[model samples]
Target: MGRTIFLLISVVLVAYYVYIPLPDAIEEPWTIGRKAAIVKIGTDLASFGELLGISHFMETMQLLMKFQEVPPTSDENVTVMETNFNSIPVRIYIPKRKSMTRRRGLFYIHGGGWCLGSAALLTYDTLSRWTAHKLDAVVVSTDYGLAPKHHFPRQFEDVYRSLRWFLQEDVLEKYGVDPKRVGVSGDSSGGNLAAAVTQQLIQDPDVKIKLKVQALIYPALQALDTNVPSYQEGSHFPMLTRSLMVRFWSEYFTTDQGLEKAMLLNEHVPMESSHLLQFVNWSSLLPERYKKSHIYKNPTPGSSELAQKYPGFIDVKACPLLANDNILRQLPLTYIITCQYDVLRDDGLMYVKRLQNVGVHVTHHHIEDGFHGAFAFPGLRLSERMQNQYLSWLIKNL
Candidate 1:
């Protein structure tokens, strides 16, 4: 019986090792291949759970990501606190050294496509700790609700609420934070939330304080066109694929499986919302150098029925790239990072162009050899280089 059980377990393990294949076309820097294989296996396991009917993909992925969380390391340079603000959970990291003046404050949002990350995760915790220590700033990382369970707008609301709470005079004074030095930063979907929040705050009548800076790391700024150069060229890259990204968008916006398929084909935008596509038209928005050989093609008109059913697809809050020039010009100093091997690369590029066109102070960094998820891993040489660039920017600007 023991031998039979062992054989069954070994067979299943072998099948997974074979079934979840790594990226076929590996770029230079073997570390990318290693990271790709790890991500592939991790993501595939979540999909496998859903296929087996054990749980939903998001739920499975959330569980898998939970295992990756590590308790905050006991460091003397920074103090960590887990608490709630405005009923929204948050993890705070503070530098231990006494400061003569108010220090800068950063509100951080974790990225997992809005469904698979936590502030407690090692990736996020390490980042918050480093930002607190290196910048000598207070960092508050929000634990926003996940999707397919909480849905769209809920994640945004959580972030906005926590940030508002942190921005209050009492809260900032307690943390010894300077009102003029606060900044917001996040990566990927968290970047989307950061951008959206920044835009909303710019126009918000209730917001008394203007943001000083917004640092976005490979942010997913738009959901309109998936046929852009990066999407077409880097779709098959292991870190983040076009199909998987559309699915993540669908999961965040709605539960309809059909809508997800339509989105993948770039058919969720109806004629009514077609006007908004101009903002995301990569051919016009992207620089010639970034366009390369990819030709632009107009997307087919989408189903009106699906469009009516899911209106969030066209909402500016969900796609910050749709914001007009007036709003763009009013935005604070912005820093954007784009990775070459990422499907969402153009999102950052176009945003940079739009911000610059409107006379907004902008700093843009394009990493030729970088991929989407590398910055989250921290220890890799590539990630470290990107981290140094980010820290350098904060030191100079923040």
Candidate 2:
């Protein structure tokens, strides 16, 4: 009986390794050039086997399954303080470094496609503390409400409110930080919020805060056209893809009811507007070099009824890159990190071009051998190189 059991176990192991295939077409020599392909793959796979309906549950399971990857790390020099923004919870990480006299403040938003992330997520918490310790800065990671329950503007509102609270209450003082050196940073959806917040601060009269820097890692900056070359190429990456992104947006707009109609027709954006003009303007926002492989084609017209129903789809607020030059000019020194095997690479590149055109100081880093969500998986044995590089960059730059 023991011998038979051992043979069966060996067979199962062999079957798992040989018959059940690993995720395929994973880009080799991962670089920004392969972004579209990777993202698409991830998107499709994530949507397979009735997964879309249970995304929240699946996400929770994924987190739970990663228990081994979330070993406790010492944060002896870090003091954690919890606060509330309009009743929403926010956690601030303050490093108790004795050598530091003055420090930078980082308002960090976590990445989970705007629908699934929380400040308590192990990876995000770890990364926040790591940043505080390495940069000798105060890191505030907000626990904004998720989508399908909270929706589009609510998440944005929560983040904006949190930022206002941080500034108005002089919260940095509690963490031994200098207000003038305050900056915002995030990954994925959080990155989008960070960029949008910077744009909002640019126009607000009451908030005279000057952002010294903005750090965005694989930020979802645009929703105008997911058919961009990067989207087409990296659509199937392991972690994030275009379909999953669209699903996230759909879930966020659950209250809107007409989001699908708008997304299908691409009517969310106006064809004749200056916003569209700026997006296609190669000389100013997007350089000719980056547009080399771009294949621009006219989108099929959507029904007028659908257009009227989903006007929010094309609003520049939804797609930050589509924001006018006036807002872009006010942006501060920017650091953008792009992963090659991620779908959002083009969005980051396009935004970088826009910032450069507006004469904003920008530092761009492309991770050639990295995939989306690589930094968050620092604890994973397979992700060591990518995680280390990300940490090194944050420490050196921030």
Candidate 3:
């Protein structure tokens, strides 16, 4: 059965890669051993599910990817619990030791492109527990609604509700959490939510706890800019290819037909949005260091119909990069983590520039040799280092 599954996956991967080859610019330029590991794990999971003849592929994929999280154990210093914020489910991590005073609080959202991934998965379990133990803070991660099923604004609403619970429920007081020291963080799509949720917190006049900060790990902040340096540079990099990202967005937003392909070509921007381009258009704003050797392209005109069909694509709340200066100015001091080989690297960089421009305190750490989703593999030394650095800053700031 194992051998059969392997052969089946090999055929599928070969077919996909061959029939839909990437531009040479993206496909033949670089090499890395870690890329093979990502492919192997993902294909193997799919193969295993197909071999088992499982009717539910989504569940199988979630289970396999979860094998990627940090392994939970008898960490006597930390205890884990399951709870809910209104209608949304959440997993909480508490340090076993009694605090001398109120502990800092962190609410996390896990990333699976808004289609897959779980806050309760062992991978996130490992991350959350480590955070709780290392920072000596309480951690909460939400299982926000997934796409194509629960739909748009649903995931956002769930995250907002969960964060509000942190304050309204006096959750901090009950758990001895520091009222003014609470913050939010997420990886990938979760990072996207964390950003939006922070904005929501900032705008709510009645918000009880002051959200002091946000930490984003290679977040997917915008769908409007496809030709950004990292998008091009990491287009062919392992794990997150340009095409796969489009698929993720398509499912998440259920965008109009043929829009995904246009998005990849950098022609997806609507004419109505032409005025906003000068701000987010990477060619003008990106530093020389970020552009590297690749030349930038002008966004060719796309259909106004597309713009009409999915105006939400340009909404500041949906794509935070499109946010106006006023909104950007109000964001809290933030920490953004970027990886050299990740497609979304430029997204993080672009946001860093925006944050700094508005004089929002911004601390960014770019890993010299890291790939997208590198932190998911807890065994890697680089992954461990990444978490430590991020946690160090988070703990200090909180």
TM-score to native of every candidate shown = 0.93, 0.78, 0.85
Minimum summed lDDT over a 10-residue window in model 1 is located at: 19-28
List all candidate RMSDs to the true structure.
3.1, 5.7, 5.2
**Which prediction has more favorable TM-score, 1 or 3?**
1
Highest TM-score against the true fold, candidate: 1
lDDT of 3 by residue, 1-398 (tens): 99999999999976654343333423222233444555646656765775787633345566666676543343788887777887788888889998788898999999988778887677788888889999999998888887657656777888889889887646778877888888899998888888888877778988867788899999988887777788777776657878767767655665343777788677878776777776677876677888778786668878898777766667666677878888889988799998888888888888999899999999999887777787765466778888989988997898
Across 1-398, the per-residue lDDT of candidate 1 in tens digits comes to: 99999999999866654443334442344555555666778778888888898889888778877888977565899989888999999999989999999999999988889888999998899889988999999999998888889877888889998888898888999999999999999999999999999998888777686679999999999888877889888887677899889888888888889889888887778888899988998888898999888888888888999878777778888889999999999999899999888999999999999999999999999988788987777558778888889989987888
- Candidate 3: segments with Cα more than 4 A from true spot: 1-60, 63-74, 255-257
lDDT of all predictions, in order shown? 0.86, 0.68, 0.78
Put the candidates in TM-score order, highest first. Answer: 1, 3, 2
Tens-digit lDDT string for candidate 2 (1-398): 99999999999855543342223443332332243343343434544623557555434433443453332244687877677855768888878767446687888998887777578777787878877887788888887877656766778888988888787545566667787778888898899889988888878899766677788888887766656666766765446656666666555556453654455444444454424645733334444654567766544444455335544445555567777888898888888888776778778888888888789988788776556787676444435555556556556555
Cα error, candidate 2, residue 297 (Å): 0.9
Name model 2 segments beyond 4 Å from true: 1-74, 255-258, 261-277, 280-294, 303-310, 380-398
